[model samples]
Structure formats: structure tokens, C-alpha cells
Target: MTDFTHMELELEAILHASNDNIIVTDDKGIVLRAIKNSEEFYGEPSEKMIGKSVYELEKMNVFSPSVTRKVLEEKGEVRLLQKTASGKTVMAKGIPVFNSDQQIVRVISLSHDLTEIQQLKEEYEKLQSKVERYESEIEKLKKRETPLDELKTKSPIMRKAQETLKRVANSEATVILFGESGVGKTLFARAIHRESDRHLQPFIDVNCGAIPASLAESELFGYEAGSFTGASQKGRMGLIESADGGTLFLDEIGELSLDIQVKLLKVLQEKEITKIGAVSSRKVNFRLIAATNQDLKKKVQEGTFREDLYYRLHVIPVEIPPLRERKEDLPMLSERFLHQFNSKYGKQTTLHPETLAKCLAYSWPGNVRELENVMERLVIMSDQPVISPQLLLLDSSQTDEPQPWMGIESFDHQGKTLKEVVLEIEQNWLLRAVKEGRSTYEMAKKLGTSQPTVVRRLKQLQSDSK
Candidate 1:
């Protein structure tokens, strides 16, 4: 080829090199040449495609009216959407290739794949759904505002906890949820049940403390029609029976009397329950999840909770740290609650950064429940969009102004000794790590230590803090 012809050829190659799939075909629709991606998208050998009718490909669906045929008949160009063999959607533009005499020589089709467009569409739909949910939640908030809905937490600790829940959700082992009251233990338990294999089945929640001593046993195990004087005409199935093949969440298990604890232990061991005033024993299959604000170990030692039951429930122990422990989550929780309250009140609202900082600084005695209540009150009462710290009622009496946890020390005065301060900081970090649900492996990797050493230190920190 001459220099000018070589330059023309190089330019043609660069133009064709554009990522779009290029298929050159004759007037009869025979594929004369195809780009590399054409083979990938169509799952066909490009070399073999030569001399073969392009419309014969499964994706092209031979009889279908397409841009290729349109360009050939009109002796012009046409654009249309097309599908590839890999189920990929594409936008194809077909232009008639003409000779110097103006005779149609072939057709050059440019295929622009719609992979990114489809992904963007999906993302848009997701964001739209989220916006709708936010609007709906706002409307609900305006009606009868509940503090629970206002709960927002984005702390790494909370994230790790959610991650762990997702991991063991399919397991059948008994789960003991340890946390202070108002820490949303029941919420976590319900979330787990919803994500578990028994999602379709009933999730019966039993507040052991709420159930009367007289009716507790019958309510849990159920009674026959004539088992008790007040029994219904039809035999009543107990909570245990109702939760068959599902999950039975026992809240405040520490409150269950020793006698009842014995019966619960038997059910856990034997996988069966005998109803009050009933002769026959019925087999039951249900996962057990127990939660408590009280110290279960102390209860066991006090001759209240049975040791066997404690061990059984403690198999998959999940200790939820108090709100004060996971201080980092406070801002997220506050913001979430603000959004929830904003929707309900039909008012645009936001939290002042300073006000939120005070909330995080304050030692939450009542845990998450307390924070939720405070946020709810702020939402309902505050006329301004931004909630201020003054609304929280954190006076000097309520909290230490200068030093929240400890009294302010003089510059010359010795407050906490060097050892005490170091120990306190260490305890706080260790507690924070544990509260964040850092596994032994994860903690070791982060702390630059072996797993065993991390585990040993964590146990020691917990003990020392206690």
C-alpha cells in the first residue's frame, strides 16, 4: 500500500478500535467481518462468522425486523436496541456502506451495549424506593410517634453486631442476648428470626416477668380443654406449641422462678413439653432465644436461674454493650431519631452538632431506650428544626459539666494517678472493641497480637472493669 493508503488504513483501524462491537455485513446480511467483542457478546467465533448470515444468530432471531434489514432496504442508516447471546442488551446503529459509484457495498453496524444504563436504572429504582420509605416513615411519625422508630445507630460496634447476627442466623443453637434494658434486645432477636430459616413460621415472644406466676406454666405449655376450669372448649396450644418449627424468644428469662426454670430446662433438653392438666406429652421443635438485663451468672449462683439452663442458653451468647459503652454510635442514633421525628411531625428537622456532642458525652444510664425517649421528646417539643443541648435537660446536677464522669480536678491537684488514667483508657478501648463485636481473629489483626493474647486481655479487661 502507498503512504496515503497506509495512513487511511491505520485511521480506519483506530476508528474501529472504539469499544463498541462492529459487525460488517453484505447486502444479503452475511457477516463479512466482526470485532473481537462481537464474539464475546454473541458467544460465537468471529472467524467462523465470516460468510455466515448475521441474522441467523440466536440473539438476532432471523425473522425479526432489525436495523440491518432497514439499512439495506432504505440504503441509509437506522438505530435500534438489540440483545446479545449472553443476554446483554445493546443499542445498534446500522449504516449502509457505499462504493464510489454510490452502490450499496455492505452494512457497518455499531453496537453500543446497555450494561451501564441497566445498572444505573437499577440503582435509581433502589434510591427511589428508599425515598418512598423515608416519606412513609415520616407520615407514620406524624400520626402516633413511637420512640422505637426513631432509633438510629451507625457505630462500627452496631454494624459488627448486625454482621454477626447475619452470620449465625441459620443455626439452631440457643442464643442468649445479654444487654441492659432498653438496648433493643428484642429488636435484634426479632430481626434474627425474620432472617432465619423459620422466617415463615411464628415468632412467639414471652416476657417471663410479665406472665403471672399462676398462669405462666399453662401459658407457656398450654392446657387441655378440661385441664383447667377456665380452659377454652378446644384445647389451647401453649406458646411453645404455637412456636413449633419457629423461634420462641424468652425475654427476662432471669425472672422465671426456679420451678419454671426446671420445666424450661426439660423442654430444651428433651425437645418436648407436657401441658398443665394434660396427660399426653407433645414433641416440639423450636429455636430458643433468651434475653436479660440482669446478670445471668449471678442469678445462677443465687440459686435462681438453673445452671444447666444457663449453659444451654449461653451456647451462642451475644452480649450487647450499653449505650454509654458505644459512645461513637450516639451521633448516628441521634440523627436517625431526628429523621424519624421529622417525618412524623411533618416538619423538616435536624440536630445541632453541639447538642449532639453533649448527648454523646452524657453517660446514658437507661441505655438506648433512654436516648430514644430523649430524642422523641426533643422532636415533639422543639419548635426549631435543630435540636439544642439545652432541651436535653443536662444541668450541672444531672451531669458533671466540666468533667462528666468525674469531678473537675485542679491543675495542681492530683485527680486520677497516672496508672489509674492509663488503666481507665485501656478498659474503655477494650470495652469499645468488645461492644463493637470484634471477633478474636479480627481483634488480634487490629491490635497486632495473636488471637489467644487478645482473648486473654479482653477477659481481663472485662473483669477489671467489673
Candidate 2:
């Protein structure tokens, strides 16, 4: 009837106006009809989409198992997650339409774009990962551990640091790396240099502590040809001059004397350095990366370090944590070192579960450097394919062992030889230290001795007579 046909046309038009994407396909999976909403969703005209295969429009569906033509033959209904050409996620539901003979004639599919929802989800996950990563990274940084090497966790820490570095790389601001020793301050300085626009220019590193007071000025600002008795005939380029249009890393900057600090502050403020015995000053266009393990605030309070210089260098303070606080990263760091040492030592040695457990238990006082050395030693000295605590000579070293000295005395102490008594004490301490995750430095500090002394004592104890 004319009335029935009019009603059907009206219904189709209403469905086409709906926000959901509506598509009609023949039983063979060929697109037969597409609603106006579908045209909007696919960013394609309805006329073009009607004649094309739905699979042809979606390219990323090759790996999906739900979009096959066999689904229409086997199942009367199917639901799947699909992505559009523009990488937008969409949820699609398909249902078979039956004819008068109770046989499937066409399949009607409705789609709802989930791009915004999925993007929100992804953003939330990224934020959560960043929070965890920074927390982990800050903890690791405090302990002189590189999150990249230790946790291998990708978050926004390094990315943000890189961005910050970019923002200030060309500026003349003094960037002081406030971190513990062995925290890769020099590497970060190099990174800043490499990322700067002056990447091709010279990059020089000067250890302020290593230079003598008499030579510090000449070494930094250069000297005239006949400045001193031992000076070269031709004036040599100092670190500052060598770093022209580039970067200079002044490591252990806290060790600089008051006079040098004053002169350095002047150079930073004036953007010029006067060489020793030079009548004139040379304008230096370079970035300064100052690193120090000492507490500048305390040094300032003690009147040893200049407050103005401290403020100048503290413009962008990058603090690096030591290794003990980022214990969660020990496993990854250990594995990396294991792999590296395995290759370097020409051994296929793998860490034993117990040894790994010990490594995690021990606090990394010296951070990555210490961990690398320990792994190298283990790989070289270990005999078995897999390293075990027994092979590490850790029976007396607390590298792996449980402590039971809280309450009762288990070992016999009566009439024991002096060596035996010392051995028992060492064993107990080592066990306790392992449980506490105390590094050699911590133990040495607590026992009032240097790290080398503690190491020597541990080695001697390991070689004790059983």
C-alpha cells in the first residue's frame, strides 16, 4: 500500500538522521546502503560508501578476527571493535535481517565512535604511568640510579627533562646538577649540549676539584703566551675558550675556591672571561653545566661558597637521587648488567634466583657503577652457567643470607678461636646487612670505616678458615 511505503520511507529517513552510524550490507558482506550518520562517521559520502566493501574502508582490520565474511554465514549477530582510517576506535554491532522465507537477506550494522572515550582512557593510563614513573624515578634519582637503566620504565621523567633542557639550552643561565656522586651528571650535561642548536660546537669538561688552585684560573680562562714560566709559547685555549659557542661542564663545582667562585660568577654575569696575564677580556658565548655533590646551602652558610654564585648556579637545579631509594628498579638494572657482563666476559652466565634476590636485597650505595662492577665480577668469577650465591663467595659477605641474630645466640661462642669468633660476628653482620638491603658504603659508614676497608675485611672473612 502507498501508506505502508510512506511509513517505511519515513522510518528510514529518521534512522538516517540518528547520531549512530547505520549501514546495510547484503549477505555477501558488500555494502548496500549507508545512512547519513555513517557518512559522517566514516568521513565518506554515503553514495561512495554504499558501493564499496566495508572492509576496504577500514585498513587496520587485517589483524582482527571479528570482521570476516564468515561471521555473517555462521552467526546471526556479531559485535566488534574497529578502527577508522584516521585511527579512531569504533564499536560496531551487526545483526542479520530475515526475509519472509525466514532466510537471512541482509545484515544491518550500527556503529558508535569510541575515539574520545578511548583517548580519555589512554590519557588516564599515560598520566598514571607518569605519576608512578616520576615517583620511581625521583626515588631512584635520590639514590644515584638512572631510571632508564634501572627501571627501564618509560614515562615522562626523561621526556620532561629533555623538554626543559630544550627550553634553556641556548640561554646563558647556569644549570647546576644537584645530585650525589656517580649520578650521571656529566651525561646529562652532554645531552643538553647535543640537543642544543650548537651541537656541532666544542664541548669541554673540567673537573674543578682536580685542578690546583694556582692553575684553575689559567685552565678555565686561558693565559697569554708568556703569562707564566711554564706557559706554552702560543697561548693555549682554556676550557671556557674551547667551549666557545658550545658547552662547558664544571664538575665538582662546590670544590672551587672563594676567589675562583667570585671570578666564575663574574664571567656568568658579564658573559666575558679574562685570561691570566691578558690585558683584555674575551666574550664567551657558551652554556655552563655546573655539577656538585656537596650541599651548596650548607657551604654558603659556612661562608666557604658564595651566596651569589650559589643563586646563580641554582637557577635550574637538577637533583639526582641515589640508588637505595629506587629498590623496585634493581631487577632491571641487574638484568642489564648481567647481559652486558655476559657478553664482555665471554660467558653465558645467568644470575641464579638467590643471587638475584641478594642483589635486590643489597642497597646500591655506589649506584649503577657499583652494580655494574659487581655483575662483571660475578660473571667473570662464576663457574656455573647460572650464577649462584655459593659461587659468589658470599657465605661470609652478607650478599645473600638470612639473619637470625635478633634474639637468641645460635652459634657456639665458647672457647672459640679469635678467628672463629671474628668469623661468626662477620657472618651474623653480613646476614643482617643482606636482610636490611644495606650497601657496603652504608655498613662502612655505620661501622665508622672507609668502603675499601669494609671490602678488604669482607674479603678476608670470606677467605677465613672453616
Number of the top lDDT candidate:
1
Query: What would the per-residue lDDT of candidate 1 be over residues 17-83, giving only the tens digit for each residue?
Result: 8888777888798887777555665666677667787556534552234567778778888988776
Query: What is the lDDT for 83 in model 1?
Result: 64
Candidate 2 off by > 4 Å: 1-172, 391-466
Note the Cα lDDT for every prediction shown.
0.71, 0.69
Over the stretch 90-197, how does candidate 2's per-residue lDDT look in tens digits?
Answer: 887778888888777788877778999998997898679556644653453354323222224221344345556667766667788777776567767766665566
What CA RMSD would you report for each candidate?
A: 22.3, 22.1
Candidate 2: residue 133 Cα off by (Å): 38
In model 2, the clashing pairs are 141-320, 141-321, 142-321, 142-322, 143-321, 143-322, 143-323, 144-321, 144-322
TM-score of each: 0.53, 0.51
Residue 288's lDDT in candidate 2: 84
- Enumerate clash totals for all models, in the order shown: 5, 9
Question: Residue 270 of model 2: what lDDT?
Answer: 94
Among all windows of 10 consecutive residues in model 2, the one with the lowest summed lDDT is 146-155
